[model samples]
Target: MAEAFMKPTVILAMTMGLAVSARTVVAQDTERPERGREGVTAPSGGAGSRWGGPGGGQQPWLPPLWTALDANGDGVIDADEIARAPESLKKLDRNRDGRLTMDEAMSPRPGGMRGPGGQGFEAGGPQGQRPDGSRGNERFAPTTRADGTLDLAMLWSQGRAVGTGPVRFSHPPMRLEDIERITPYGLMVGGHVCPIDHGYFYPRPLTPGQPHFDVMSPADGHIVMISHRTQLTGSTEQQRDYDDYALHIEHSATFYTFYDLLTQLDPAIAQQLDDATRDRFARRQMGPPIHVRIPVKAGQVVGKVGGRSLDIAVINTEVKLPGFLTPRLYGHYAWRVHVVDPFDYFDEPLRSPLLKLNTRKVDPPFGKIDYDIDGRLVGNWFREGSGGYPGDGRDPRGYWMGHLAFAYHHVEPSVVIVSVGDFGGQPRQFAVKGNGPDPAKVSAKDGIVKYELVYAPVNSSGEPIELPPHMRGVQGVLLAQVLENRKLTMEVFPGKTAAAVTGFTTGAETYER
Candidate 1:
């Protein structure tokens, strides 16, 4: 028999540090005043009101149902008046029952009271109704009707994942046990798809037209060539270091835009044909065209007109690699480019010996370690930020650190083992540094890494507490010490007074590359 996953249950125990209580559900009807009830007024006063009001009095707070109920137009409400409104009558008779019972009126329909695609309150017995009869803890709760249908308006009002937000693309509600059965390889949430590898390495495939390359040595770095047609390029590197040490590298890239040359290469892109992209390429009316300009070793402008000159470089531009990954670890790497006119380009990982290089181990004089998190060494978190809109003037347009980073092509989700520490610094300040396989020589199928972390909290007294065999409803913090040769005490802040402080640890392994 298939194991049933446990459904998320609302725990209402003082020991659990949750304050939840059952409450009575009630319904009430209000009367409309001639001048509109207090807190109810026209959006605009007097003549500005588009629709005429009762006796020329604007009624702003009148809900559509209430408006429909006010059939007599006396600017007052009563049972007779409500009965006269057909729409209100239909709404009140939710089950189509002759009379409106308290249960029928209060119970939400399968589709919910909100419109289509709306999010509604969680369905079940009413819980957590305040003395004033308001709901709390609704943020994490699903908005649903009593019958389990979602409220379309509420869902839409919650907003869709537009640019970027956590929880976007998250899996729908499922029982904890069922999650494993349905998503054996993990699940995709918030636009991120996490496939389960169960501690295996699987490389992604390279797109067409891109060549394979490798890193022969650290000094003999690979060269990246870019052209108008080449939008993106990606490479992977893996290495193994026995001793743990922090690594940092400085890098830069140059971008070239041919304002005048683009005008001549493709007149359509040069002149904006549509008002929408008037400042962009002329092909704005038609779809933008892709133009590739390969630079020769030596070149001079053969023709000059309209203040336009065409010049290309052996290597168009460069960008620095942020923090390094641990050695022997295989992870996907790629560079993406967005062309102004033509389609975007992705320089897929190359699988060629020409780009391959053996990494040379270098030993830099150790700098004095200043920061350290005093705790059992468990795991670490490192990230090379990616996938975000270009920075604007106010904010540096680039990926923000701490956004969950993973490869899209990989068949399995990338495991990230984060070591919780008490070092009270900005989160995501740690780095992973090491060498790995030459990206040019390895295929996407060969670059993969698996990692996971388990955290246990310790009490404020620096004593480890045994958590209940089965515990829930606890939140805490972890700190780390980053500076070399420095010991720093870290603390975990568990909201539960009786919560245990069990240390946590994470395990990770690299593959292929």
Candidate 2:
């Protein structure tokens, strides 16, 4: 009964792991969590290795679909239990209005956009001073460009731009032919931003005996972090299988690289993973990050990948992108400010093929992520008064409750996505039900505009399928008004239609660019 403007990550990633041919995608996450955690299999097929069939056949940023519909704790949905749809969907309708609203359909996220624990996406600040004019703690922040999207600092200290280090990528992360598709940096899928490249493997539609490839280091650097993890897959016990892995690597303070979907960690560094506690991996979760410092050579193997995709992203601390809008809000995911194209740093011969594999038609072959346009409704917005990335040092409502973005679909830039950190008290994203009153065209003078939210599906190549009535599956409505260029107000009405709502109520929330 309920679908999405953009299907959950797996659904959106058509034939992901089963790569007969290579494809290119656009891509996030600063320092992210492990790729896929082991979890119970879902019967009706969703994201994550095709609903728990095997290794995560997804890019690092395409979050697996987590659902409340897996009733009975059995990880499945049966036909006889079909009657539960209405009631199941109703639970998200907080006010019992018989209709769903944006907030009602969403749930609260503990952290901001990224759930994986880390240092934080934004920099705390080095020359930073406290509001009271007192000296602040030693912190790191990025230097940015005039556009507010990226920075080109020479080196750095505490996330600030000091200057650039001599960063030269020697070896390729993987053999060029080993990859099927290279999802470029800056993608919008599953309602979030992907600030890195997701390299899908070759030999489409993997099997038990599928051959795996080695993930190597691109430069000589010490290992900084490793996401040691395991995942359970299969639709039933008889066919069930599992995978264990450790995804690792990072060059230096100036140049950073990350990998995901690794099935094994090179023995040398595997022993260095910390003795930390971790829950059984689940489809929508990542393993806890293990901190370590191990040196590695440029061509040395760091890990391995076989049945799924391998996520590869390179970040240059020397530069920060301004499109993220509020740097502090994204502190935990620090790399967001400086992510760049690996091709730019790679050795010539090796670099050419990787670039050839890219499918993005954008200006920079690497693709673009930061979309914040100062006075327009086309970028990220933070709730007013919300303390940077963490939030107003208080209750369950943190960065998630205050974060919001009006971005594009990662696959199809033309499709508009209205992402909200909190709507009707929960987090979710949507497409205007009838796909009207575009966010880009609505300015402060537009006053208050109403939107009915619905799911608009896309095709195999990542293009929207405008099937008219089929795409008009209304689930909720949202009321938003751009106060001025940098400020706005919003409210959600679950299970309601645009005509059913007229104005913002007392509960309306205010947001800033």
Candidate 3:
């Protein structure tokens, strides 16, 4: 049976209505001890009040244990109760004295890695036993015997660590319903570029007016540097997409050079350009910088083009690997343009037109995908219908924007690799690989490509695990999807049978392309 824990909010809300106003007793049921904690042992036949007296002790801490164990309304644990107690009760003997004191029973340490008695013992007893084991030393495990009596011993023997106290039982810091905004770190830049006469570049149709889109920056940022006639010194393979239009952008920490944009600009814009920029423009080598932030607003025109699309090429940005230097997109690169559905950013009227074309009606044919068990924002999807093109291209036979793969192992950190590909036939591969930890592996079987990359474990909020530090580990799986309504509807659960695709879902998403 699946176990469920109450959310902190639910627990707090329930306690609010159940709490009773305290009534002042004309005479105290039991005389107050000069100085002692709750659950203190009382002399035999004394007042049977809470605080470990008779009437089945009712101190808030371990009330059930005290009530059940202290049979015949005696506050203290006599030899009879100790004899029938479970093995876990022995752990509360902090001094190794083999007897549980009020202080030891009241205090519970953190859960999970924290074991009983402050020693690294397993949190609970073997399975099939009652819930009396130490689950991370914090809360007690609730258990009952066959006779319907609250079994204090069974709780101690079978308790399993759940989580740290107070914090664990409290409501999560951020609930899923409270969050409204989601951002995509990956962005794609689109524009026209001319092929260099240099070496090692991929083949293109090179049509006179064909537009190119690259999985780079969605838009540009402030210009920080410019160069004129900078010697195109790298070898052809290293400078594959070389453009004399090199200039740096601040927002994305990257560079760009658009070949077709140089001559089209008016003198007003060109006068602001540096001498080097003007000189490069005169030679028809580069264009002025166009800075724009990502998640471009719908209907917001940053530039006007004569063609239906733009051609994007991955240009040169030097990266230093252990053994050598190579050209790559710098910083945290995101291919958002390809991975995100354009409709997500549009207003209802704007998004409505696209939805009508999608054919899913009533709502956009989309869903949100989350991992880490916690409610961390991952990515969104739109069902691939007849009118829609796979925005983050996974369609093997068509021009695709990108491809992503995940590899998982029981032991080793999980790995996620996202790469972009072409619109060609089957058996396509990515031209660039993202930077990740070591021990990554890649393979393919039956047309499905698999890559093993580093994946660090996350917390309840889906952020990387850190508080306990040692709790972090790796996990990964290959993602294979089935599409509909021009969007992704379901994916093959990795590690299971290759053909088994189950579960239906939809939502607005931005990451994990």
Best by TM-score: 2
TM-score (C-alpha) between model 2 and the true structure:
0.57
Please, what are the lDDT tens digits per residue for candidate 2 over residues 1-513? 344223233321322331111111112222212121133333211222221111111221111122333333222333322435455445444466666554443331223232212223242232232222211111112233333332322112222222346368888767766777666654433323222234333323455676678788888876644443333322212333345454434455566666766777776665443222122132323322333346689889887777666766666666767676655544334345666766778778777777766655554666666777666666777778764333332323322566677766555556676776666665666767656677777877788888888764654245557767744677688888887647888888877887788888898988875
Per-prediction TM-score to the true structure, in the order listed:
0.16, 0.57, 0.21
Candidates' RMSD to native: 27.5, 17.2, 30.2
lDDT of 1: 0.20
| C-alpha lDDT values of all predictions | 0.20, 0.50, 0.24
For candidate 3, give the lDDT of residue 184.
17
Better of 1 and 3 by lDDT: 3
lDDT of 1 at 410: 17
RMSD of 3: 30.2
- What would you estimate as the lDDT of candidate 2? 0.50
Task: Return model 1's CA RMSD, one decimal.
Answer: 27.5
For candidate 1, lDDT tens digit of each residue in 1-513?
Answer: 011111112111110121111111111111111122222122211111111100011211222222234332233334454334444435445456555443433332223333112333333222332222222112212133332222211221122212211111111111111111111111212211111111111112324653221101111111111111111101011232111100000011222122111112222221312232232222221111211112211112111112111111110123222221221111111111101110011112311111121011111111000111122122112222221111011112111221222221111111222222111222221111111122122223332321211222332122355767554222333323222221122233333221243433341211111
What C-alpha lDDT, on a 0 to 100 scale, does residue 295 get in candidate 1? 22
